[model samples]
Each structure stands twice: as structure tokens, then as C-alpha cells.
Target: MSADVIADFWPYVMIVVAGWLATDIWRWLGVLAAGRMREDSELLVFVRAIATALVAGVISKLILFPSGALEATPMGLRIAAAATGFVAFLILRQQVILGVIAAEFVLIGGWLLIGA
Candidate 1:
């Protein structure tokens, strides 16, 4: 290969290695630790709860105080969709996919109805 081709490839190779190092190291460690960790342990339960809370907080933030296109959607519609989805999730025996679909349908339908 010519030097120019190697030069172009060098940055891509560096990016791949950098990205892998940034994410894969922790994932590898998690895999190693998972083998020894109990799935039902209190610590694991607490970790899961914290992770869920963090996700809920982020989603709530986005829905409540969104930017760009999301900001155009009414607050009541967003809240209604979330409430409807939660009810649907409960009704469907906690099937997340169904719940998410219900939520998306509500969001899109509301957006169309409101002409946002």
C-alpha cells in the first residue's frame, strides 16, 4: 500500500482503538465481575434501582422541559402519553414493548392533532 493510503487509515485505526479502549475496558471488567456476582443480591438490587431512577429522571427532564422540536409538543400531551403508556404497561402485564408502542402512538397522534 502507498504511504498516503496508510496515512488515511491511521486516524481511523486510532479512532477505533480509542473508542474500544474508552468503552470496552469497563464492559470487560463487568463481564469478569458478573461471573462472581449474585444476581439477586441487595447491592445489585440497589444498583438496578439507581440506574432505573436515573433513566426515569432523564426521560422526565426531556418530556417536561424539552428543546427544539420536542419543545413544540404540548406538556399536557406528553404527560398524558406517559400516563397512558404506564396504564397500558400495567394492563399488558408489564410488557415494555407494548407500553412503548402505546406511548409512541399517543405522542404522534397528539402531535398531529395539535398540529405541532
Candidate 2:
């Protein structure tokens, strides 16, 4: 390839290699270990609980102390959106994607209605 083509493509190649190195090793390890893990294992349960808690903490942080465009929205609207989403999630048989869609719809709708 020409020097210009190499220069243009080198960054993307580096990004792909870095990303794979950063995540794929752990993924491979997990795949190798999953077959040996029991569904009722304490370690698996603990890992699941920790993962759930981490997700909850992140979601709570985003809702309570948001930055960027979300920071511009009112606190009540944010709470309402979250509550509506939770209700939708329950009503929709715990579909996470539906819950997220419901939350976004409420958030955007409220923002539009309040002209904020």
C-alpha cells in the first residue's frame, strides 16, 4: 500500500487491535470457565449480584447526578421518567429494551412539553 493509505489505516488497525486485546482475552477465559460453572454456585451468584448492583449504581448515578444535556433537564422530570420506565418494564414483562424506550419517550416528551 502507499504511505498515505498506510497512514490513514494505521490508526483504525491499532484501535481494533487494542480493543480486542483489552476485552477478548477476558471473554475467552469466561467462555472456557462457563462450562464448568454450576447455575447454583455461590461464586456465580455473587458475581451476578455484583453485576446487578453495579448496573443499578450506574443507573442511579445517571438519574440523580447527570451531566451534559441531561443536567439541563429538571430533577422531577428525570425522576418521573425513571419511574415511568420502571412501571413500563414491569408491565411489559421485564423487557429492558422496552423500559429504556419508555424512559426515553417520557424524557423527550416531557422536555418538549416543558419547553426546556
Candidate 3:
């Protein structure tokens, strides 16, 4: 390739490499560190709790203050779907996949019911 052609691609190449390094550096360090940590360690327990809380908070924010299409749906439908999912989660012994599927089913059914 000509020097001009290589120069034209250099910025894109650098952007991709920088983005990868930015995200993967921490993941690489985590993998290295994880091997030395016990599953039931206090740090692990706290990390799990924080992760769960963050997930819950994000879901709550989505339901309570949704954007675009979700905002078009009634709040009651959203709440009902969440409640059904919560029940399914408990009934299925905290099976996350099943609970998410149940919630989606409820939300989609509600959308169809309301002619959306």
C-alpha cells in the first residue's frame, strides 16, 4: 500500500486499538486476580452485592423512567410484568433466564392487548 493510504487508515487503527485496550485492560487484570480469590471471600461477597444492587437500580430506572417506546407503554403494564417476573423468579428458584422470559412475555402480551 502507498504511504498515503496507510496514513489514512492510521487513525482508525489507533482508535480500535485504544478502545480495545481501554475496555480489556481491566478485564485482563480481573481474570488474573480472580484466580487468587476464593468464591466465598468477603470481598467477593461485597462485590456480588454491589453488582446486584447496580443491576436492580438500572432495571428500576428503566421501568420508572423509560424512554421512547417503553414510555408509550402504560406504567401498570410495566409494573405487572415486573411483578410477574419477580414471582416467576421465586417460583423457579431464582432462574434468571426464565424470569426474564416471563417478564418479556408479559410485556409483549400487554403491548398486544393495548393494540401496539
Candidate 4:
């Protein structure tokens, strides 16, 4: 291929290769080992708990000690958004996407309302 063509496609090629290298190998390994794993296994339970804790920790950090644009918003607004999202999550049959949407709506709405 010509140099111009390679230059145009290099970023796209790198993105595809990088994405595959980052996630697909682990996914394939998981699929291969899934048949041998039990849902109720202690290892699975521990993994689930660790994953949940990590998510919670991230959420806590974002709410309590935000950075950049988020830091501009008040702590009360942040807490309110998180609470609204959790309530939405529980009320909407645990649909995570809906909860996230609700949270974003609250955060953006509050930010706009207060002219922050």
C-alpha cells in the first residue's frame, strides 16, 4: 500500500489490534474455561465479591472526591445523583443502564439548573 494509505489506516488498525489484545484474549480464555466452572463455586463467589467491591469503591471515589468537571459540581448534588441512581436501579428491576441514564440526567440537570 502507499504511504498515504497506510497513514490514513494506521490509527484504525492500531485501535482494532489494541482492543483485541486488551480484551478478546481474556474473553476467549474465559469461554474455554467456563464449561469447567460452577456458578456456585467459592472462587466464583470470591471473584464476584471482589468485582462488586471494586465497583463500589470507584463509585464512592467519584462521589466523594471527584476531579475535573465533576469537581465543579457540589457534593450535595453528587450525592443526590448517586442516590437517585440507586433508587432507579432498585425500582427499575435492577436495570443498570436505566440507572446510569437517570444518574446522568440528574447530574446534568442539576448542573444546568444551578448554572454550575
Ranking by TM-score: 2, 4, 1, 3
How much is the lDDT of residue 65 in candidate 3? 86
Q: List candidate 4 stretches off by more than 4 Å.
A: 33-35, 55-76, 87-105
Candidate 2 lDDT, 88-112, residue by residue in tens:
9999999999999999999999999
lDDT of 1 at 16: 81
Candidate 3 residue lDDT tens string, 1-116:
99999999999888878887878997898788778789979999987898899899998989988998899899999999998998999999999998999999999999999997
lDDT string, candidate 1, 16-74, tens digits: 88887878997898688667568888888887888799899998998899888778788
Q: Return the TM-score for each candidate structure.
A: 0.59, 0.63, 0.57, 0.60
Estimate the TM-score for candidate 1: 0.59
The most accurate candidate by TM-score is 2
lDDT of 2 at 86: 94
Between candidates 2 and 4, the one scoring higher on TM-score is 2
Alpha carbon lDDT of residue 66, candidate 2? Answer: 96
If both were scored by lDDT, which would come out higher, candidate 1 or candidate 3?
A: 3
Question: Where does model 1 exceed 4 Å of error?
Answer: 1-7, 10-18, 33-35, 57-76
